[model samples]
Each structure stands twice: as C-alpha cells, then as structure tokens.
Target: MLFDTHTHLDAPQFDEDRDETIARALEAGVSRMINIGFNRETIPTTMKLAETYDFIYAAVGWHPVDAITMEEGDLEWIASLCSHEKVVAIGEIGLDYHWDTSPKEVQHRVLRSQIGLARELHMPIVIHNRDAHEDIVKILKEEKAHEVGGVMHSFSGSWETAKLCLDMGFHISFGGPITFKNAKQPKEVLAKVPLDRLLIETDSPYLTPHPFRGKRNESAYVKLVAETAAEIRGMSFDELVQITTKNALERFGIS
Candidate 1:
C-alpha cells in the first residue's frame, strides 16, 4: 500500500480529470491521501473532496502567503472544521520567505496561532516551510509545537534543520524534488531520517517527479517519489512503501 500524505487534488489544474487522476492513483497503489486546504477558497472544496472519497482526508489552515487575509473569524472557521471526522491535521501552515505576498510578521503570527490551535485541539500539524528554515524552527519551538508533532511537508532543508524537526518528533516527508539529480541535500536528509519517522508525499499538481518534472503532478506519481526514497534508503520498494504507509496511518491516526 502507498500513502500520499500531502496533495492538492482540488487544484484547478485537475479540473478536467480529477476523478480520473484519483482512479489512476488507486490503480498505482495509493491507498490513502490528504488533500490540503490552505486558504478561504480551497477549504470548502477540500472538504467536499474528503466527504466524497472514503480514501481521501483533509488538512485545513491558512497558508503563509495568504496569512494577511486571515481575519479572527477565519481562525475560528478552521477550528470548527477540526471537529470534522475527515479533517486529520491542521496545516500546510508555516513561514514562506520565498513569497513576499504576506509580510513576515503576519506569517509568523498566523503560524503561531495555528500551532496554538493544533496544540489546544491535540492535533498534529503539517508545516509548509520555504526559505525560512531558521525562523520556522524558532517559531515552532516558541510555540512548543513538539506537543503536537507533525510533518515537515516537502522538506527541503539542510540535515541540521531536519535534525531539529526530528528532535521535535516531526516526520520529514520527501516529495518530487528528491527525485531530481541535483537535489543533493534532500537526498542526504532522507537517508538520515529514522525509518519509523519517514514519510512520502506528492504535493500533487505541483512537485511532479523526474521524467515528469515539467508536467502537472498527480497522486499516481507518488510511486516515483516512493521509488526514489527507497533507493536513497537502500531498501526494497515494497519495504519502503510498507514503512511509509504505516507511518502515515499512525501519524494521522487513520484507521
């Protein structure tokens, strides 16, 4: 079995063939998926997808780039959704220095609030850190995120950063980037993560893996990510899939 622990199947990119793509993923052995809803618009669509598909799950939070748009009521909305049976995590949240759409201060405040909410609700979080490793680690520490340890989605940080997340009981997930030849750091970090804490994802409609790098990504392509991860850890493909699937299930508390 395979689990794409993160994805965005609700993205407009798949508007024409979303069901077909999901069917392909199942055929390729993806037994479970978590669709991320990072803002006001996507959250409802994501919830709809989860409600429609038994194998699909949801993660709702305000994205760092959209942090400026998060009003007080928005936080309450996310909190309300946390009670939904299909909502497994509070995330796709964190700092994103790469995008200047939202001020750094706003991103920090939003991330801190989400972390607090997750901790208060006793739910794991899914972090989306981009080009702000140091600040992300600092905020997560200050917020005491270890109380609700989560996944470092599409982790592209150095081994040192990975080590810190690992110390906080976070799972380091690799995506399409790891399948790239020049992705030396992610490859190295993947090798170092403990097997039990390892996870894999597609970040679908984005980070499409090698041989399909420039095209739109889908959950089926997570097999490519799984194969690359297996190669990095020097384990059989089936073994890696079993470990990561189990890790994903337990991490999300999926039955």
Candidate 2:
C-alpha cells in the first residue's frame, strides 16, 4: 500500500469531488494519507477529514508563507490538537523564500518555535523548505531537531543537502516534481536517497505528476510518483511501494 504522507486535501480545489477523490485513492492502492493543515483556517478542516475517514490522518502547523499571521493562541491550539487520535505530526512547517509572504525573520522565528514544540511533545515534524535550504538546515541543527526527527516534504535539493538531513534523522519525501521531465534536482536526489529513508507524497491540489500536469492533483496520483521513483532507483514498482509505505509508517509512528 502507498502512503501519501503530505497532501492538502482541504484545499478548495478538491471541494467539488473530495469524496470521489479519496475513493479513487483507495482504488488506486493508496491505503493512507496525511492531510496537512498549514494554517488556522485549515486546521479544523484537516482534523475533521481525519476524524471522518479511517484511513486519513492529520498534521497541523502554520505554513511559512503565512508565518506572519500566526498568533500565540494558534500555536497553543496546535499543541492541544497533537493529542488527538488522528493527529499524527506537526508540520507543513518550514521556511519558504519563494513567496516571501512572511518576513525571513518571522519565518525563522515561527519555524524554530514549532520545531521546539515538536521536540517538547516528542513528535515528528513535517518540513516544507523552498529556496531557503541553508538557513533551514542551519536552524534545524541549531534547534537540535534530530531529537524528534521528521520528513522533509517535497524535497528539491542536492544529494549533499539530503545527506545532511538524513544525518539529522530526517526522512526524504518526494512528490510530483520527481515525475517532471526537467526536474533534474529531484531525480538526482531520488538516486541518492537510501530506500529505507525514502517516502512519497502528492501535495495534492498542487504538484500533480506527469501526464496529469497542469491539472488538479489528488492522492490517487501517488502511483505515478512511485512508478517514477522506482524507475529512477531501478527497483520494481511493487518493491518501491512496499518500501516507501513502510518508511512512511515508520516516520509517522503509524501502526
């Protein structure tokens, strides 16, 4: 079974046929999915989805783009939700230089705070890094995030960077970009990641895989990401599925 470890199923793009999208994922052999709650607005929706579906889980945090908007109460609320049966991790949290919606200093502060929260709670974190690799890695190390470990969602960095994250006890997760024809970095990173530390995600309602590019993404398309990852690693598709599914469960502490 495949596990889409990071997705935005709560995004409005899936509102039209969310049920059908989830059903398609199950039919496509995606046995589990983690809906990422990246902002206050999506946190309740994410939790609701997890509560409503046995196979869905949740990870809550403030996205770096919205870092400036996060208030103290929001952090407290996220911490409170961590004990929920369906909440699996603290994430979709990290630095994003691409959008710059939030100032770098604020993003850094928020990222560190959440990382500290995850450590205090003894929970794994799900990171989202974009165009701010060095600082992100530095902050994680400074915070000693290796204590709780986590997944680097939708990784798009050099093998050197991946090695650093792996050394810090972070799993490397790949998404739709790996299937893109011109995505050299992701392909290179895929070749270098150890199978045991590898994971797959769709980041759905976004990053749709090849052949389905430019269209709305959903969890069912994780199969294509797995297929491409398997090919890149020269492993059988079934083997890739089994290995990544195991990795996801291990990373998330799922049974």
Candidate 3:
C-alpha cells in the first residue's frame, strides 16, 4: 500500500480524467490519497471527491496565494466542514513568499488563523512553505503547532530546519522532487531521517519524478517517490512502501 499525502486533485488539471487517474492509482496499490483544499471554491470539490471515492480523504483550508478573500465567517465555515466524515486535516495552508500573491503580513495572519482553526477542531495540519521557511518556523512555534502535529508537505529545507520541525513532532514528507537526479539536499535529508519520521508523496499534477519528470503526475506515480526513498535509505522498495504508508496512516488518523 502507498499513500499520496499531498495532492491538488481538486484543480482543473484533473477535470479531464480524474476518475481514471484515481482508478489507476488504486489499481497500482496507491489506495489512499489526501486531496488538499486550497481556497473557498475548492472546499466543496474536495469534499465531493472524497465522498465519491472510498479511498480519498480531504484537508480543507486556503493556500497562501488564495487566502485574501476569506472573511471572518470563513474560519468558522472551515471548522464546520472539519466535522464531516471525509475531512482528515486542516490545510494546504502556510507561507509562500516565492509568489507575491499576497503580502507577507496577510499570509501570516491567515496562516495563523487557519492553524488556530486546526487546533480548535483537534485535527492535524498540512503546511506549505516556500521561500518563507524562517517565518514559517516562527509562526508554527508561536502558535505551538505541535498540539495538532502534521506534515510539512513538500519540505525543501535543510536538515537543521527538518530537525526543528521534527522536534515539534511534525513529520517530514518528501515528494517527486526527492527523485530528481540533482536534488541533493532533499535526498540527504531523506537518508538521515528515521523511517518513522518520514513520509512519501507524489504531490501529483506537479513535481513529477525522473523518467516521467515533465508529464502530468498522479497517485499512480507515487511508486517513483517510494522507489526513490528506497534508494536513498538503501532499503527494498516494498519495505519502503510498507513503512511510509504506515507513517501516513498514523499522521492522518486513517485506519
């Protein structure tokens, strides 16, 4: 079994053949997937997809790029959504200074708010950190995010930073980027982190690994991510899949 811990299947990119893609994944033993929500519009789609597929689970929140339009009632709204059977976590939320879609202050304000929502709802969080790692670490610490420990999805930071998140009880998730031939930092971190502390994902529709690097990624390709992790840790691919899937289940509370 394999778990795709972070993916934006709600995006229009999957509209063409979402069912087929998901079917391929399940057929290939990629049975569970975390479909992340990234704004007001996607919350419903994410939930709907989760309801449609037995293996799909969801995390609802605003991505930093789209956090601007949320009003006061929105956090409450997300809280209510978290009560649903399909909702597993709170996020796709956090800082992203790489793109100036919104101001840093605005991102911080919204990120903190969502983090609070996750805490209030007693759910884990799925964080997205771009060039704003320093501030991300700061906000996570200030909010005491360890209370609802979750993943730093698509982590691109150093082992020093990785250790900081680990200290806070956060699991580090690596995606297709870790499979890149030249992705030295992520590979190094992959080798050093204990298996219990690591998770693997495809982050599909983006970050596709080598041999399929420029193509559209899906849950089915999560095998490449697992294979890469296996190579990095010098373990068998089957063993890597077994352990990471367990890691994802523990993190998301999936049975």
Candidate number with greatest lDDT: 1
List ranges where model 3 is wrong by over 4 Å: none
lDDT by residue (73-152, candidate 3, tens digit) is 98888999898888999988999988888888899999999988888888999899998778999999999899998999
Model 3 TM-score, 2 decimals: 0.98
Model 1 bad stretches (over 4 Å): none
Give the candidate order by descending TM-score. Answer: 1, 2, 3
Candidate 2's C-alpha runs over 4 A off are none
The residue pairs that clash in candidate 2, if any, are: none
TM-score quality measure for candidate 1: 0.99
Ten contiguous residues minimizing lDDT sum, candidate 1: 68-77
Which lDDT tens digits does candidate 1 get at residues 140-196?
999999999999999999999999999998999999999999999999999999999
